[model samples]
Target chain A: MGQPLPAPDATDPRRAPDWVRLLEARATAHGARLAYRFLSSRGEVVDTLSFEALAARARAIASVLTAGGAAPGAPVLVVLPSGLDFIAAFFGCLYAGLIAVPVPPPRPHRPDHRMRKVAEDSGARVALTEARLVEQVQAVLPPGADVWTVDALPDAPEAAPRTPGPGAVAFLQYTSGSTSDPKGVAVTHGQLLANQAMLAEAFATGDPTSDGLTSKFRVVGWLPLHHDMGLIGNVLHPLYQGGECTLMAPETFLMRPLRWLEAIDRYRATTSGAPNFAYELCVERIPEAKRAGLDLSSWKVAFNGAEPVRAATLARFAAAFEPHGLPPRAMTPCYGLAEATLLVCAAEAVEVDPAGRVCCGRPPAGATVVVVDPETRRPRPDGEEGELWVHGPAVASGYHRAPDASAHTFGARLSDPDDARVFLRTGDLGYLDRGRVFVTGRLKDLMILGGQNYYPQDVEALTTQAHPGLTSGGAAAFAVDDPAGERAVVVAELHRRNTEDAAAARDAVISAVLEGLGLSLSEVVLIRQGTLPRTTSGKVRRSACREALLRGDLARLDGMTS
Target chain B: MTTPDGTPPEAHRRSSRASSAELRAIVKSRAQVEKFLRLGLAEALGISPDAVDPTRTFTTFGLDSIKAFALTGDLAEWLDRDLPATLFWDHPNIEALTGYVADVLGLAE
Candidate 1:
């Protein structure tokens, strides 16, 4: 049922070059059609917005923003919770030709360092949030930056949407970098549309003419709207296809994953997805008795991405939900990142490699994926593991305000003379088997747990600061497979080999991580002095340390063994 | 605080800031609440109910942030009321959490 997108026409303005124009066209054609439905945690629809109403709200917010001295192309932070207000504010930024920076709202009674880091890095002078959270958002924003409540904006007369050039930065997607330094990927309007179109083709979403089944291409998702997968894949994908999207807060799903399936069944969602942990959570938490009276037969595409796709997770999920009318073929394991503006490759069918890694399928049209040896910068043959280098329209322009990092990551050149194209060095190690991509491991030491990225250096820094026994710069943080999912393991060398000190240090490390980063360590191994693996330059080799920890080669302190 | 159909009780349906007296009247007995907490913690940590010692902190059983949040969510669902997101952090051990819950529901005798 999937088909390739039509060629771009530079002359035809009605074809919707950017998201602003796309929404304008949809407003004109499907003015009364339901665009979004925001649901409460109790499975009740709290708010609904039609295309026309959404356009009107966006225009009003845009007018207010412009009147408040927001210059076009300036970054505006959209720091609201998961609701229709967040969606309207995001579009309002585009309607005003401003770059939208979507960040998670600050938690209650917590010091929001991440929000402050994002606000500082994006250089956003204005933030848009709900009435209830205006004060909280304002507290974390830079001193001069102002916060406005989106819900209280007065209605304004409709104005024509601004059509910025396709190359103009539409939004800044801040990847989960370190707490001190967050990286915001500058995604242009052209790149966003290209990735959405590719998703439409790959998932076969919004195919109204395919059959009666394609008539209602709805999507139900509970992923956090601040993240790339939730914003691009769940929220925007439905609008791109002129279909309705039903959204709930991420906490709603995590609280009871059964609500996700119940909503999908109730809404007859044709396309929906989350990270692999969500599916595993459902299979683990949802009892068999709760599966009664649910009908997922109408569900078509269940895309899994944003983290490693485990063969065991997919198989277990399918086995658990198959009785509820979920087709085994609907389990789509895809791969993507924030730098790529969302999707890179997606498999149509569930396939596994000999190494138990799920096949991420081939790159979509208009995207070229090549596996290359990172050290030699030469292309690797099929079935050989190498870094995945991508060159495509979907790739973002670069990191905002980071020239060196942008050049190092986005301006990669292969050593092969035949291929002169510049590629985005995806720091992800994988191998291509006859054109299909299979991710083996991460070339970068980034740990992804619960669809959130955690840099090891950040974890190690927090671990070392927790106690005096933990030697400074002697901690190595890494992820290991657990029954629940990937869990963080902190291996630190103690300053002294005292058993009492080791126990105290372990407890201190766990509490510090939880209090500082709001994360829990699965295990904390305190090794003797100089037992950790380090390079000649004294840089900790996380992979080597992880191997040593797993193999029990490290001389762990007494009572610190797993 | 669940009805026969497992829906939240009337007191919990009002708001998150319900009066303690109203909650006390509608909530289950303290022993039943403790049993539920132990069972829920065991289910979340994937261990037997007996293994869930009331004296030990949740961190001792390797309950990470996500699992702790999920356990809180389940407890909220069972009691049919919204609890603080930092419920686990504020009440580190089962004994402390049970005491907090009892005080909130006015179960102190």
Candidate 2:
């Protein structure tokens, strides 16, 4: 039953259309086999669930949900700590034929406004949570939302949920927008399966290969489950192939990133990835002197995505771990967004591009990715840079009920008069070089100075490498429209303890920008560490920083001046 | 959100070390606990210490869950007491947190 049934490519019809069908098959075939294992902050396995056990719990939860009479396609918010209960509740909602909306549990330090906005926007009437969080969930929940802990549900499916059709809504994935605003993308069941197959096909993960389909690969990562990268890449992808994932909380990894590698070493895991900062954090945070006897020989597919995939970060990470048995080609750079269901283009076993940019491989089979000049809306030839346009079955139906916003982003067509096809306009700017997508920078963040466009990454990287006094990962470069014209501003953060070096750091930033861009910076405002604002997912919100600069709202260092 | 003292902005405090005696002094009294939380949160958020209102929740003070977890760990070590990860979740604001810390650590006065 576990034999690789069919095609290893994108059209692998064996990649079941519905997840519910797959789950039932997995339970019957791999009943005793472990489906998931959750690790504690100490890196110990705290909970383990088998496919059979998971199916039972999910069915019970489904019964509770169905007995309660939730609407057919209503979104149910699943907010809880990372563990087996979350897994059960998630599949439970799926089994009940209700759209699952997974959100990070409310943290006291973060604003609830975003969660409240999502609840209202998605009109989620039922929230699946724990006893301790009922009060808090109710605080933001609409008057009708019924908060029930996973344990509070009945222990059996009283009424079996009808099997969802191909077009049935699967879930509403909320985009990690500015903290002040939130957006949800409606993903259909068919699209979700399409992405599952695309990822499996692109990465050769869980597919039948020349040696025959061996379900030996296990996913291990601490990427948060709420993010698309985490939900779709780390969790669901593993489940889709009847394989298991060993997961630890994001805080656990951040608190001690070495534990992420150490977990992979201990578990003999083969697949894992996080954003670029995670790889950099391992190198920066984990001193080689202390990482003794570590072995990463089994690791592969160290994906770098979500944020811009930096070539330098990959090189540094590979070099640092090379002694511990990491393959040079294992670091795969991918590019995608929530609008496209977490996978748009990915490298098919690629290496670093010589030009210092990791080549994000071609789009998965049946998906079309084109580079389009935003101004002319015409397709740019190979090796030319432009906004990336993605058209695929995996593309989201639209933003939840936000027609104008959805139409603006989802209904974009190529500039060619003869061709007619809708494309998901990824606001990222990049070029198609050698049939691969090399993401350059954000379209919103592209800085135009003196009739020439400058991507912020070039200037930001220079400012970072320009001086050792400045903190790594703490530079924001954006163009401001001053009275004269468009002028570039660099807001850099000096090392926290070295307050006296702000002056020297500012000079270094200026010199670096001048050297890199051959243009003098209009202003180099050196601030304290963690000053630059980041989105919830940790990408620098340069536009927000630009607005703050224009208004002079920066929390500048005492001696630092623009 | 300017500092009321009209003083220069303070620098980052995460890297420095404090004496055990100094750490004890921070949790000595309820007011001291409140003051400690206010300044600690202000530093974490990269905002003015005066900008942090003791009555405001940590959400208002700008602590994401990760930093909030770090805060609990730090507080547990500083006060030399067992602290729950959900401490901030239960005590939403600094005032409540301070009161709870004082009561639990026997520093209410």
Candidate 3:
């Protein structure tokens, strides 16, 4: 509500550049601004915390973590849901100079594979979780590590040290690892500052403050904080812009899709984001009664990314909520990845062309997105489809402990061989049509049958459309190459009663997938909905599902084979 | 709704009409139903029974149709409940769905 003093110059040694400083800055300026709200089902704020309060708690947490024998730079795996405590733990780690590795919170229905993968990959010396996960984390803790809840940590010290500097490593974000082994992308404070500054510059151009400070913008999000999009896009961006944010647990968003919209209305959130599926969920699930009295005029930036951006999903959401004052341009379908510190190209909140569409507008000032041939490493023509390569300050310092992987994914040249530009090879396959990124699909998820490439999403989409019983957005179509040659198999979850016969369900699923995808599915395993493994962010864990199917350990769909 | 040690008056009356095993099945299915409705039926109804009656109305469990749709669509999948999409309104509650399952396939004890 008031103009704040300017932040000290970049060279000032007192201010550190990591996320720790982000919280500290907020505490210094507008410390009383509401940073979080734990909402009830009715969208009432059940609990609220100010930025200064959160920062102080984080400083306290940093003292406890350091006192608990946590070595600086040691990987501290965080397995917690989105909330005030989650944010505190994340920033506390940054303050203490520890590497934060966020894993999805465990689900009751999922097999132990996710925990196993995280434990193996991170080699975490400590696991910070909630009371609900105490026993589970204890049971799943790797050979050597301590597990503690938020309450278990010691009180904040009255005098905690200042935030870490810009050169400090902030996090080790593990890629989805669908193609190869999961590699941790090391993000530095300087890299984060650069990316967030670019993002703020792009979105905050109309912002009234010439000092690059903002007080009007606010973020409301339900995306999993563990994700790059959630951590940087929704959380850090708001803090960097000197604005506040409201966050809810991912389950809250998934369980009640309309609650997301209600939060925007209640909080008057100016900016928010989610992937394509989230918009699809809102479109399919928001009830007519719940839609009453809803106004989305204040929601300025609604980003769709983390997965391929779908034009139809955006169109449906816009059409359904137009009466509620939901703007078409506010539904921005963007593109980016973990390598780029979460964002690459985002559409400005503006009206789309005549064609019912959502465009991932253009790369921000310090960024460039080029479609390149995966084989030749040459930039393709303007409108051609190829691997999307990104160059920017957001391009993170490569994989932790894996120099070879870092080299392969982060640097490749065009022409002259020796003159190379540091570019992140975003394993995403897409075409540049009119300089806008139209994501086709993931290169790793592509199935090659008879030498023709087929995207799994195409088959999965058709399966959901054909069979009402088949779970939407919960199917996996993957290629299995054996002595019998390569064949595509679609594993779909079916909604049915336990008393229902299995043979009938399997037959129905196979027929539906076959007819929909126009290819005979090598196998159709009718798993119970939610039985399929999923990331903490509610994304269908395709890699885990494929591994389960391959190992004959897909529990609910076991015993019967189609 | 009552404490874990005591049954609610409505639940007590409903349980008298069904056997314990049948009630257990209903309770098991209600877990699925909670996923179906997405709301925590246990918390909403304020009932912590290890089992529930299969023929009672979902309204008795303190849920309305609007919240029921959210649960059925999203929560059901997250909770691993595999009920038909239309079942949210049809079954409505643990007891009603249990009764429906029994009538369809004689699953009642």
Tell me, by TM-score, which candidate is best: 1
Local accuracy of candidate 1 as per-residue lDDT tens digits, A9-92 = 553222477888888777876788898998887779999999889988888888877777778899998988899999999999
Q: Is candidate 2 or candidate 3 better by DockQ?
A: 3
Model 2 off-target regions past 4 Å?
A1-14, A109-111, A155-157, A207-213, A348-355, A445-562, B1-109
All candidates' TM-scores?
0.91, 0.72, 0.69
DockQ, structure candidate 1: 0.28
Worst 10 residues of 1 chain A by lDDT: A5-14
Number of clashing residue pairs, candidate 3 = 12
Model 3 lDDT tens row, A116-145? 566667678687788888777777666657
Which of the two, 2 or 3, has more lDDT? 2
Off by over 4 Å in 3: A1-16, A155-159, A178-180, A209-212, A349-358, A446-476, A479-562, B1-109
**Chain A vs. true chain A, TM-score per candidate?**
0.95, 0.79, 0.76
Q: How well is candidate 3 docked (DockQ)?
A: 0.09
Candidate 1 falls in which docking quality class?
acceptable
Error of 1 at B47 (Å): 7.5
By summed lDDT, which 10 consecutive residues of candidate 3 chain A come out lowest? A1-10
Q: How well is candidate 2 docked (DockQ)?
A: 0.06
TM-score of chain B taken alone, every candidate = 0.73, 0.73, 0.38
lDDT measured at residue A376 in model 2 versus the true structure, 0 to 100: 85
List model 2 lDDT by residue over A1-562, tens digit each. 0223365454332345577776776787678789899988767898998989988887888888887789778899988877779889888888889999888787654446557777878888998999888888898887876787985664543667457866888888884443324568888888988898788767667646533323577889787677788888888887787777899988777655777998888877778998876887688656675366688887867887877676677778888998887876678888888889988877865556666566888887789999999888999999888999999999999888789989988999877877888999888888887778887666777564432346677778878887787755688998775422356788877777777877667766765565344445767787778778889887888888888777777878864333
